[model samples]
Target chain A: MSIIIKSSDDILPSEITDQKVFEGRREFIKKIGFGSAALLTGGHISLSHAKTAAGKYSDLPKSAFSAADKLTDFSDVSGYNNFYEFGTSKYDPAQKAKSFNSDPWSVAIEGEVEKPGVFNLEDFIKPYALEERIYRFRCVEGWSMVIPWVGFPLADMIKQFKPTSKAKYVEFVTLYDTKRMPGQVLKVLPWPYTEGLRIDEAMNPLTLMAVGLYGNDLPNQNGAPIRLVVPWKYGFKSIKSIVKIRFTEHQPLSTWNKIGPKEYGFYSNVNPQVDHPRWSQKTERKIGEPFWAPKHDTQIFNGYAEQVAHLYAGMDLKKNF
Target chain B: MDTVINSNKYSSSLYNPALIKPAVFILCLLPLMNLVWNGFNQGLGVNPAETIIRTLGDWALYILLFTLAVTPLRKIAGLTALIRVRRMLGLIMFFYASLHLLAYVWFDQYFDWNEIVKDIIKRPFITLGFATFILLIPLVLTSTNKMMKRLKRRWKTLHQMIYPISLMAVVHYFWMTRADFRQPVIIAIILSGLLAYRLFVYFKKQQSI
Candidate 1:
């Protein structure tokens, strides 16, 4: 049996262009073929050149994990940040990170892995194809943004390191140069910021080792070169400017958690039901929305519960939070 | 007595209230005007609501400090005419505080009474801030020349609440700040100095008596 798909009526021969015009057009195209070819090819070359010129990963494919929500403005995404290595204020990072050097960076992968080695950032990222994952980034301060982060799954990166059976958790550490990261000079939450994830959480497909955002190299303030992006957790859990990763048998100490154990818990998952000690987490103001706009009702696990809720199966989020 | 009289005469000649009042008034309104202009022009940065709320609170705290500073500044600097703008500055401080509360209520909470009530009850910082604002209401109401004359001796006692109110405001700020207590520390130091000056003057008066 032949399938009969509904189709539009075909164009009649009577509507076709005259032979004289068609032939003349062909002759004209041939006359300008060299210039046109150069123009066409040059345009193609420039377009591709623009992509690489912006960043190595600027032309990445979108992942299925990306959120459908309207992306936050690139200015807002890069401008307003909480990279305490630069400064404590949201705007301070953007201002103070201008002179921050992230070039020739290396990340040491150590601890319970069979292959623990320090690899240059390029070699570390060379194996996987970067993807654009537009995630809803919720801060513990009751604000949020939908960012288009470009990176591959952390699970894929973890597999190459070959974590042993003893690896129950993964720890990530930020660059601790006191001269480069001026904020480290102050005794703010202990220097060399550290964050951790359970092995399963680290291996979750949702976890991203991001290198860029908004089709450009990640701004220095937004964690240049490489950083972790754990969608289900608060922004602080997504450690920035990572210089070290270690697989451990126990939950590693985190900066905020160490500073305020009663306030910032190690499992800093975004749960609206569990309020921060100083502020409510039930609602969050979207970064770029108007001042009069009503705050969005924060979702459990930042609306990634379908993918990650099972991770916290029987655990009480309030107590863990 | 002669020195006080001489200082007053010197201050009155150099610092005319007519020019000083309008100048101080405009200076106080500048922050508000800048905020309004930025609101219209999209100059309040990524988080406009936060900037507006914070700007209002900061100005309120600053003006509160300035209001507190007026007494000590007049006495120490021998600029007795500076007291003419104290009432105006206090009123302006109250105005900013009200706006700060309104911004939090309207923008942050969206006028959700249930959430606001929970915040006031559950959050220590909010409770302190709300209490401070409440304490300011009677002070603002009794600020008028008419109320001052009516209340007479009781008015001085009532307005003394400003000392405690200012301390509570700083504490409220301290509680809300997550880390980097530099700003709060600086504010507290200035506040302590102002309070210390008053205490010193009070004890000196008692000793003389």
Candidate 2:
């Protein structure tokens, strides 16, 4: 049930000592005759407070991209999602995604990889060290969220498999099943949502293969079991509930780009200068913020410019966007 | 003819604006009230601005179409007093539409006129919606009895813009939506039916003449 790999290598013994020392000292005192139920209750209450004060995932290293803003309430994070497979409305996915079964899920790694074939979801990530990364998620629709995701660098995962030189692009495919995903009844998007990234982009240190968020197992609405979290690109580039990953020399057919080539480009990087055909991407309203809260200026490469801008050095972001 | 006579008699006693006007006023205010209540209670989901925008937009479209149906319904039900409420309904519809625009301007754009203008020009949906709002201004201004009397025949012709305005609103809704377009599709069908009904009545009147 624990999707996060809480290995000794990833979580240092110091972290465990840090968590237990105070509580352990209290327990030791309680065993000595002076302890009473009321005192024990008071100590227990303080211990819970200490846990939160320490940080949600105290063991994991804080991500460089962590936003200064407070973490959006978990309710909003789970209740607001754009999983088209469930439904169109933001609320629809939270309500309707319950039907999807992500358990016993496996990802098929094929095309130009040295180790190519089906791999169980758990086994696939067992090798790499898992960590919590707080990333700014910018949707193409001019809205955003700062999500605390638990995963490892995508480059680490791909490196283990050793992609062949032919692997110029990394393609991700979402699970497709009409019975579970009723929104498929409408031709809003091509079935089995697809997304792609340049191999360098995929290998970027910021790229994450997220399996948990808010220090818990990923909600179905939030791409349960496993999903991609590409901090620099627009959210659609971070496809959810991935079932297939293929490496190719040629660029893969991204679903949004295929659906509306002009509006949604294959790159889909966050750029304030390049406006979407329907709306301006210059600013984004952070979800869960008050109506009066000033909209934040959208950054080029979603504020990861220093980390990712090098990949697209000479390329025109205006055209690629 | 007999049904009309009977309904006409019934309407006189049943359709009292003294009672209906206040009731309709409260009914019209329900969507706004619900939104405010949700805002206070944190019931408006994660993206409350979006929920508010979409909810207000739906009410605006609903009231617009409902206002347009008044004439046909008045004739069919023989409720002559229904005409008395039509102006109010039309104005309320406009009120909701204005709020919808305000939601986008203040919450979405944050009073950024340059960006908004750019969006209005660059985006077809915003353009159509903006055009529809612009066309509605004259009709709303002229809804008063004094303007109606002053313009006379011209008033009737000018108000006919509602037919196109309604269609534009529907198109605006259709374009705004990305996928699962059932709501816009249904609204479009109803609008077409309303327009077709007007056409059928127009041709019938011409034949009789």
Candidate 3:
């Protein structure tokens, strides 16, 4: 079928923001055409933090993800999940996220910020440079998914905030509403699950704000709206359905750490050597592998040691973990 | 629900004895049919052996509970004629229970006698489930009319062992479910209440006698 496509460049931000044209595009009742012109309309293949200024990182040689020989394929991504709000089951997130909607999402940038305001995702993601970085995602349940995340590193985004000395920790909060996120209705977990990282950890170049995954928009089950992507840490630290990003002086109590302090720690860094009390963390079953195939050994820093390991040089991981 | 279970169509009349028995048999097969369908689909992507063992084991305990309920239901429902089918249903419970136990040993643990022995020794849940299976052997062997006649005086006394077996089965299920005990807890409560009712009846009967 011959398809007529509207050029995204000629369309002004004001015209694009106009309700009917954008709403029609958003609803997408008709199929979208991804032709050469569509590609020409500023759809990039590499990294940014929703920056107005593009091509900053393009000057720096792309070395991290360029090492990938192939796009990671899974037999299934179904088994890997991190829905702690639904009682920490591997299947909980997908099963309980029926109420979560990404349609009307506004992230609140608050706490020690001059521009403490809600940012709508529609306009928010439009101007940003989208980059693909294939990173290994390790779940606490001993399973892993190789995800090609499309967003700028967390350092780039946090720099935009211009934090004062008070910004010791970066606290992330999930949007909590029973109507939108039914998992909230499940009183089994404490409400508005939160996770935080030290300001230095958040400023590390490896940390990312995941906008798209697997070369496409993240599915609702995988935390669609805007979520942090901490590669070296356990998968749970990469909080999902995130609405608020706060710069706080005191360390905030994280949901998992509060529920089971012994099992989950505030640092929660990926250390295969340190076993979880209930199960061995030495190795993890790579999804799509045959049942009898041996589990591969997990890495101390999820194999990003060179990039992030130096940040925690003097501290003891065993105690912090 | 009845139509989904059994398609044997006929009018229910007081004189129709033959139609009722086969219809009941078909009704019983619905769960077995679900088991067969799920088994064919590689056990519905669940651990097949675990699924089969748990389902059959739970059902076996349920039917055993139902078999014990026969005397009570007959007393309550006041249907003396229902007595005849209780033995057959009780034996079938033993049959399914045996399969459930066999699946765990054969498929799940792969008949590793050392592991099996260790499991029985270590896990209280496994020990109870295993003990429940062992107790059923004598019941099944003595289910025949000939065995009943041969051990007439002792048969009534020997069959009372099912009470302990039922208790063990409920304990096995209850102990195994660590959290979200929606199904297992319900079964435990029902079995406990039923056994309590039996105790009440036994004491009342003794008092009257």
Candidate 4:
């Protein structure tokens, strides 16, 4: 079962154009009506306007991996969503979240961390360099998407804050505003949604603190300001509009797991062998795929088991699930 | 009293079962036609399979409810001819329900018998919906005039299962939805209203007798 592993470092210098040139190359390719950059980098061409602007965020680092598949259409990524704070329907968030106020936001990082204080969104993101990583996002509800996210690794951010030795897990909390988020008035789920990850999982290189998608600031519906993006776990684990990050000694009760423990587990890794209580999780229908598109088989740890399997060395996934 | 009865008869006569029955039959096909048109035209949205499955399920439930309302409508409106369309409505309900089941089997389960069986046993919502579909089988089979004449009183008893089947449909819907029970809640309210009307009519008839 040993496979030749090729990290992005193994890529040839010619394969990766300078970030500025890459940005310009995208537009040049799009203007010519050919996916030339995709041909060179084996990167997916996002069908949505490609890039509305060629300006690259200087702070973010160049991505390590470019997916072989096409980036999900931007409309599908932004429009079809499950940010229940806006509403329960898939279309609800886009319509309702637009009015949500994310400006002048601050996030408080506390608990077992050495530096514990409220930092405004701008200052918090200023220090870390952002990277455009294309990752597979799998939802517990049997759907998936490949998104090119603009962010830095969660570990890189956590290291600067210096988590104490006692820190075993990290907890994330979302904003709790019912006035703007009409859906919060109804108790579809416990308000002010929360999610958590093991400290080791949090420190994983694949975990991203996303600030933007497709080289633009996140749309209101897509967890504006900042959100966690854990590629291996279920999409819910990647909490949105995060206001607080607390390093904890014990596992935090995630909102979904709190409401339906039997249905949603804390460690919701994408494993085809382990099915959800109500539905089979063996396959997922990619968003915006054709009606006749055959569902692709669910991959273990969403095809990141090579990097993340060691984190859960001896625990039974079925039991944890 | 004579004038009121005459007016009722005049209005009822306007319905003209021969014309109304065929018109209603065509009207009942509109949802299916729209669904098929949308399916062909790429109007079924991003998830066409899900849309088809859900739309068929919704129409089946609506048709079943409509079929259940026929007796109550006839009694309340004093339109005896309304009873003529009841059989047609029942067959239509069966048609949509069968399609719903087929869509789920073909698209969702991919004709995976083992998976389908597992779904029925493991998922309470599917179990209830499956039972509801099963109950329609006898009702649809004996919907013919000859079978109705052969069974006589027992046929009515057999068809009465529609009440419980309708209840199961609502409950199945309620359970399947993740949240926002508004749709199922509305369905529940409609079924309750229909049931209440039947009860009121039954009691009034009993008193009159």
Please tell me which model should have the higher TM-score, number 3 or number 4.
Answer: 4
TM-score of model 4 vs. true structure: 0.86
Winner of 1 and 4 under lDDT: 1
In the range B25-121, model 2's lDDT, one tens digit per residue, is 7889999999999999988877878888899999999998888788878887766556767888999999999999999998888888988998899
Chain A TM-scores for all candidates read 0.83, 0.82, 0.76, 0.86
| lDDT scores in order | 0.85, 0.80, 0.67, 0.81
- Every candidate's DockQ is 0.69, 0.63, 0.08, 0.45
How far residue A152's Cα lies from its native spot in candidate 2, in Å, is 1.0
Tens-digit lDDT string for candidate 3 (A175-278):
78777776566565678979899999998877888776644566676777677889788898999878889989889899889977978899888887665655
Candidate 2 docks at the CAPRI level of medium
Residue range A203-254, candidate 2, lDDT tens digits: 9898999988866678899998899999888998999999999999999989
Clashes counted in candidate 1 amount to 0
lDDT of 4 by residue, A95-147 (tens): 99888888999999999989999999999999987777767889988888878
Model 4 over residues B26-138: C-alpha lDDT tens digits?
89999999999998897886567788889999998898788888887787777666787898998998899899999888777777799899889988989999998998898
lDDT of 2 at A248: 95
For model 1, residues B98-193, the per-residue Cα lDDT tens digits are 999999999999999999999999999999999999999999999999999999999999999999999999999999998789999999999999
> Model 3, A200: alpha-carbon shift in Å?
3.6
- Ranking of models by lDDT: 1, 4, 2, 3
Candidate 1: pairs in clash: none
Candidates, ranked, DockQ: 1, 2, 4, 3
Candidate 4 residue pairs that clash? A60-A130, A61-A130
C-alpha TM-score for every candidate: 0.87, 0.86, 0.62, 0.86
